[model samples]
Target: MQQRFETIEQYLEWMGNNNFTNMTWDIEATGLLDETSIDYTASPYKIKPSYKHHCIVVEEHGGNILAFYDGPTYVFDGREYTERLPKASSMLHTEEVVTLKDYTPVEYIHLPLKEFKNYVLKRKIKRVVAHNMINFDLMSMKLVEDMDFTIGVEHRDGGLTTWSADTWMGKQVVFDDTLVISKTCNPDLFGGHSLDKLSRRAGGDTKIDFRKHLAPDVRFLDFAADMLYYCIYDVKANTAVWHWLQDHEDYQLSDRDNYIKNWLSPIQLEKKVAEIITYQEHRGFVLNVDLCEKAVKDLDAKMEERRARVEPVLPPRPATKKFMADYTPPKRQFKQNGEITSYLQKFIERIGAQLKEGDDRTMIFEGKEYKLPLPADVPLKTEMPAKIGDTTHIKQWLMGEFGWIPSEWKETDLTVDQKKIKLPMENIVAKIDRWLDVTYSTAYKEERLDGFGDYMKITPRSTRAYVRQRLIDRASKGSCKVLTNPSFTKGQEKEMCPDLERIAEQFPFAKDVIEYLTFKHRRSAILGGGMDWDEMEDGEEPEKGYLASIRQDGRIPTPADTCGAATSRMKHRKVANVPRITSLYGAELRELFGVGDGFFQIGYDFDSLEARKESAYCDQYDPTKEYCKSLMMEKPFDVHTMMAKRISEIIGRQFNRSPAKNVKYGLTK
Candidate 1:
């Protein structure tokens, strides 16, 4: 009979002697997958094992090898082997193989890169552990050899992997990774859950700097010894860390809470989340891409046309030679012989000529006097055009030449040459040096498309208007119950319908533009009508579905955190109801998330669960002993109406109106 091992050390010994399995985890790849190429229908890029060296560490016998090259190799049980490296540098050698008898038989086997996958499949290994195995090792295997390995059993509960059905090995095999597990177990070690750190924490005897051996072009013959030793040490360290976790009291307590209390282990929950996230990533929402593109193009053309109308009104050149020159006006002048010198002296003299020496020249309008500074004594040149269109040009030229211009002027109040003006500075400069400015209103016609061909960014006001229009559209049509509820507060309704007239009067042309934008924003899940094609594969259409991410704290977030809700009963900040999407989104948009082929969505809720729980708790503490009984009555009492009637009875004596009217007034109160 076999002896049962009770301790971790004894179990490890048993595993080493009889139940152990070997797996090589390190990968030599040119680079990570291009994220931009993955989206909608295409999976992330997979690395091919054949393109780089393969290192395998055998756990049972503390052996390691570097394979996939034509060099001196070993064979075990008629299988072709690759070069063997010394195990003295391995951490597992000190712990497991150092005390073995010299005459004990030890077999080292290595195969070509192409045969590695076949060997793993043939061995029927039950559990394979590695760090970051899902992204690096397993993804590389799937990409290179088209093999599918299950990570957890719950992931197979739904028909999610039906696409990979042909390549999926049976449930007898599963791959376990330590990256997420370690992070969850040791969250205080934030951002320090790398394999090296975990190995040290687990008291491993050896360490290797694996990044130093990444010479993909170098032949395996030159670095086999070091590469094999590093691989073995990594495996040993990973195993040690995993064993440490299994024996850890805190980890065990957490596992028990997750299983016994939550009915799902942390690993199971993580797998479920990964599955959902992957599905959502692959199943992107459908959009009317063609409609959006056309809308953007038409809006761009309209904006350009409007801009062209205003282009002829602007001046082709500076209004004065001073504006064209790089000269700057002096700030002040010093006094000479009790008289101010430079341009300031002439400016002050001119001001004294126009008004009393002690009083400044002022123009009074609307109960306020605006001081108009006199022009400085600067040299002037004839730079104005012979024929100008409006008074703005006269002001521009005056400002450039004399560093002074009338702060206020009307189009009808000025002459063509600005000489016959009815206000101050009427004849300050010669008519040839004055020009008119075009009087057209200067309004900005923002372009619809940006430099990248996406819609122009909108202001927060416009965003609010878009949301308001959506709510109003839904409410007016009686399509949404929440928006159209008669009892709902005015403030809540105003959030979605705040003074549309103000918006429309402010931007008359923007009404149609905003309507088009609202349609694009609400119909499609993307704002500004910009679809991220890089989220999916190059040529594939986005999948018609929604994706959500489930956090460990029991919250699931939709894209951009726009929508989310909690799963646990515990109170959380700003917890939302996930099912409210049905109420918020229109039917056409909601229908996009149809059940995929061979699968159906099952949704259930605890009907009035909170109200019942509240009633029970109240009854337990009630001195009257009637609250729970009243709640449990078959007919069910209208608590609000009953309270209203009781209040009406108390107040009806003061009123001559009918009892029904009294109750109605009470209910309103």
Candidate 2:
């Protein structure tokens, strides 16, 4: 500590505010007293010896000295009681009673605990500020639950004031921010085990890291956005008050890395937290049905399986009511409403997935399946007198002796002649016990044992269908009412054709044909023209919407009639792009090829010229035409054969066979 008082007046002023002592340090009969003696000040405000050694040293500039003890009553166990003591002060402070009504329950499920602690410590903290702290405070304090406490006493006016029950110490506090005395305090005396200390209990050596465990990017401020109700301590009023911390983006707490942060962010979680508190405050604890069932079923299956493996027909009597009643199953109780059944159901489902179905047979459920072995027989004294060790040998010996029958048949088959049947997993233990009793009069042999092998060897891949079925089963059980997956049901497609027809009926001119020829095929008389459909404008129409028309009932429309008229143009212009033809075969083929001086063009010209010359003078025989009379003298041309051969060549190439190989001509050589 550092002391800085320029003048004596300044030093005295400083001394008045702080509970420090100087030259005025006095030795009262009870002990040493600092200038100002307050109740419980020594225990609550005084520094511990360990911390005093390492606490920031006070230079001449600043230091704080709490009331201290010097003379002490040495009244120990059997020691000489010779010590000085201080006389009692006439005035004493009374303890206040805290009631449940005094506290305002924390409205928000999630809180920025670190920031809350800092807020408390920012100015000053005195005695524990809790209402009905004897009970309600204790319950609320359990919410954050990572703090420690120790007993301490308060002193006032140099006398013993009051005995503080539990002083809280840590970055944790519970406050019913509404009532003045409704709060629990955790004083951070020693550091290590405070609420800030991390524990390794969750895993082998690593603590469950909230930062790694929870979703990132979430904060307490985000949770407070929808706070239901909460409380804050009014240090000035020395009272707790209630209000919602909702929508307070500015009031963010620091160091948020935990499930509490993430779990509380959702709106539903906020309601759940509050409901749980309310329920707990009303009810003590909850009953967990699922945990109870699982424990009982697991133990029963194992016991049954063990009994099924032994042999030789030793049978134990049926389980009695007294034995069954002695078994106390595990229980789990939800601390919240609307949670008990759902939680129990989920737990049951998980347990069923993990449990063995029955003795000596496998069962299939939800794709993954299980098989349970019969329990080994643990023979009671009434059933068999042989010790457990002897039973093992008895079972093996009987199995070897009964090698005449297969193991399965011997174990399960009914022997009508003998009027008996080996019962399941029980046969192994019962028969073994019987044999051991006959073979041994005393203790039997014990053998070296090895560890058990892995119990789960098969893991079924969970298919979509299996999950869907399981969900259906859960729904059938009345456990989950909502079908979370949307695909579980089919959606109906809506019809659009009716709406399209309605629009078409409103535009009447669009129903005609060839009515678009005017504007659609407009040609300039002076110059070959172009029709432009792009230059159209949209205009207002009836209540339905915008409309357009084109060519207006078969009359040619100029640019003036074309405003929105083009809509009907496309309707009647459906056949406008067809081609027209006026030429004969050779001329049409030449035009089709679009060739200049090409073979088709030349052929068309020769055919036309020869046709004209023949028609001109062929009334009987023409002197104007030279019909190639020389060709008559030459061998007659076999045009048909040539044409046939050409056709055959084309067909052969197409069919991929040889024309020459398939064709025959008489005396062609």
Cα-based TM-score, every candidate:
0.37, 0.15
For candidate 2, write residues 382-409 as lDDT tens digits.
2322221232333343333432111110
Worst 10 residues of 2 by lDDT: 52-61
lDDT tens digits by residue: candidate 1, 561-651: 1011111211111111222334322343334333435867564677545446656777768788565554443332433334445555775
Pairs of residues at least 3 apart in sequence or in different chains that clash in candidate 1:
39-535, 39-536, 39-537, 40-536, 390-436, 390-437, 392-437, 393-436, 393-437
Q: State candidate 2's TM-score.
A: 0.15
Off by over 4 Å in 2: 1-315, 318-669
List where candidate 1 sits over 4 angstroms from the true fold.
1-19, 22-24, 28-110, 122-126, 134-136, 151-174, 183-189, 192-237, 252-269, 272-288, 291-669
